[model samples]
Target: MELGVNIWSFIDRILCWRQPCACCGAPGRALLCPGCLADLPRLDNPCRRCAEPLPAGATPLCPRCLGPRPPAFARVHALFAYAPPVDRLITGLKYHGRWEAARLLGSLLGEALAGADPLPDILVPVPLHPRRLRRRGYNQALELARHAAARAGLPLEAGRCRRVRHGPPQAGQDAAARRRAVRDAFAVDGRVDGLHVGLVDDVVTTAATVNELARVLRRAGAREVSVWCAARAGRTSGT
Candidate 1:
């Protein structure tokens, strides 16, 4: 069962690459087969502020984001839910040395925003801690940002934001724990006054990392900061 699931998931992720449709086994050309693309879980009714999946017939803002303390970032745009093929693609890019997955994910994000207006002035890929960077040999976020920025014809500003503190992986942490773990982990090295910046990443779980980085950017004079991620884990109540 597990192996079948993994194989299917792998096929689903082919939507972002120029390969045969994993689902229909068609000629490889586009990112995904139409049938498979239609099967992917898309977040249509997302929170206006944070882009969390909204409940059926719920308001634009999630309860957690509607609480007194608003998020630092202006908005979030994610392509898919953090499940199945999407999750597999992210994991493959980050852990399995799959650079093609990064490029494909980034391209998908770019295409999603093709017709949108008021695009970001700069794209900043979330930074990795020096230790982690050495271990991974590359920051997955940076690779994605490069592709997204190039496709969108936007400036890609990397290395301006640095991760100063290395925290434990956020895989098992709850909302509060995730917040605490990332709190003070980032620092802005240059000015971004009045700039509309977009922060790119592979996945958003609790959104703790992007929030902390957005806070830093705001403090450094950024006028706006938005998040662009490939997937979001799930919705969270206002906490």
Candidate 2:
């Protein structure tokens, strides 16, 4: 089994080598070439809680998500600031079924989480409604979460939670409407009590979905819920 796995890995590497970079069409071992990778919009001095870009020397939590009442998740870990090439990669994998983009993005997310002191007990891909799951054939979040779990040496507990409600695509909804659509959309099944759970998703725009999911996990006695997404979209329409 080990030898067969190694052979397949070698073959996969060869195949990846032949394909051009998804961003700039550069020939390379990685999905995105170094030049395009460098050009990707990385979050700079972001608010620790929401991963939104903050003014220099601003507080850890953004004003919009901060208040007397604490937020659902502890913090968000995002690689990019949702723009240009990063957006293309997300859209490609999510809408166009580009598995290579998912793998590359997940690997980067794993690398970022590698140094976490107290790693999450399990990684949970945000669930998709049964209708959407059937239509899409596969959940992009699950694909990315599987790759990230392997890289981070963690277990993926995708079955622990489920989406019970189906709503319209969040892309066209404002923040308030998004919240309403996602309310009570998720339910935890298996043991999650007191466990540190990490919610994995591709992009976090208004964060309504993750917030609602986190609320469910917390009610089920989860110790902490941290969101991990490939990109964090800016608050404004165009940033």
Candidate 3:
């Protein structure tokens, strides 16, 4: 057991290349080069409600959000639209234990939130079930949130929320299925009354996971919940 733990610890230390731009293998640059960073599929002029990418100067709210029913979370802020290098970086940190990916991606998340008008009072990383946490040895969301919270000058509360359900993997699942899988799956354990809570996650696809989590946080007396994801993803056919 000790040997296995040590092996994973080592793996976690070098999940991906630190310098030389992991994506294009260009030397001298950091994990991501400036050219690649500029070309990344970022969300431009995103909707305030869902963070859906919109045309420049388009309406602040998307047509869907203009409807009567909105989401449980008040807003979503995302840096990139889940694609290509961003997806690879996230996958490396999430599955292969690449600590550097978290450093790079988390720093980018922090940079994006640096000048926000209203930042959340506290950062709460979406929890992973104990089973997954033990298997992975770290929560990617927490790792990313650590950097973001530091840059944003906010407190990170990793223990505020807990995931009790060990649902099947959510990748490629549509919104409705994900909704069904995560219903009542989360429990809030900390005091959040009147506090503007920021929920951090690695990726947002269909927004089902964050939405369910927001419901739980609100029930626990949070003033309002906002989601901050490193990337916004498009729903897949199904995994």
Candidate 4:
């Protein structure tokens, strides 16, 4: 029965005309073509602390994050650098109204989490403020989390965290400025005692937002926290 369903789904996808890759009219599943996927600007080596792509042979932590570590326990994993095809993929999901991209990005995130040295107990996407949720109609992070959770077979805690404050977008902000903007922004919605939580996001920049969120979860009694993001900006490492 499942095989029959799978075959039907595959055929349906091949016949569907509405959902083709914008970059190349591929008949089946893909936001970007295989050729485009190969051309994506990948981060070779990112900072261990903040997951920012770094120059070749640079240290693990960027100077800023090293000076005063961000609030999380340790380590961040990013699938790609915030440039070119990756940047365009993220932009399409966030702004151009392409939600299906989350499925593709989420699958990669799930694979990365699976390879982590220590796996987390629960997956939590960074919460969107109520106002932003109303405007956007869907939380991209949450959508990504749902897809990743399905792929990884990890439990997803959608209601475990809440955004208490809504602020301007973090674009163009420096590290310190971004930290200040997101401070006290998140609160755990339920018990997290001794739970190892994996936080998901579409991108990580200064580590400010995730740091602030991890602090909240820790304060709520979480035992450990790690971050998983689809893209990282600014620094790099060989991992």
lDDT of 3 by residue, 1-239 (tens): 99996896576556543568877878643677888878888776778898876678889997767888678999998988888888888889999988788887887878777776577888999999999999999999999999898778889999999999989988877778898999999999966899889999999877788988999899888888998899886556232
**Cα RMSD (angstroms) for every candidate in the order listed:** 8.0, 1.8, 5.4, 4.0
The lDDT per prediction is 0.82, 0.86, 0.84, 0.80
* Per-residue lDDT of candidate 2, residues 81-192 (tens digit): 8887888888888888998898899988787777676788899999999999999888999989988998898899988889999898887678788889999988899668
Compose the digit string of candidate 1's lDDT tens values, residues 93-187.
Answer: 89987766777788877776554466888889999999999999999999888778867878898988999999988777788888998989999
The residue-level lDDT of candidate 2 at 179 comes to: 85
RMSD score of candidate 4 (Å): 4.0
- Pick the winner on lDDT between candidates 2 and 4: 2
Best by lDDT: 2
Would you list the rank order by lDDT, best first?
2, 3, 1, 4
- Superposed on all Cα atoms, model 1 deviates from the true structure by an RMSD in Å of 8.0
lDDT of 2: 0.86
User: Which prediction has more favorable TM-score, 2 or 4?
Assistant: 2
Alpha-carbon TM-score of each model against the true structure: 0.86, 0.93, 0.86, 0.86
Scanning candidate 3 in windows of ten residues, the lowest lDDT window is: 9-18
Where is model 1 more than 4 Å wrong at Cα?
1-18, 22-25, 235-239
Model 2: clashing residue pairs? none
Off by over 4 Å in 4: 1-21, 24-28, 68-70, 235-239
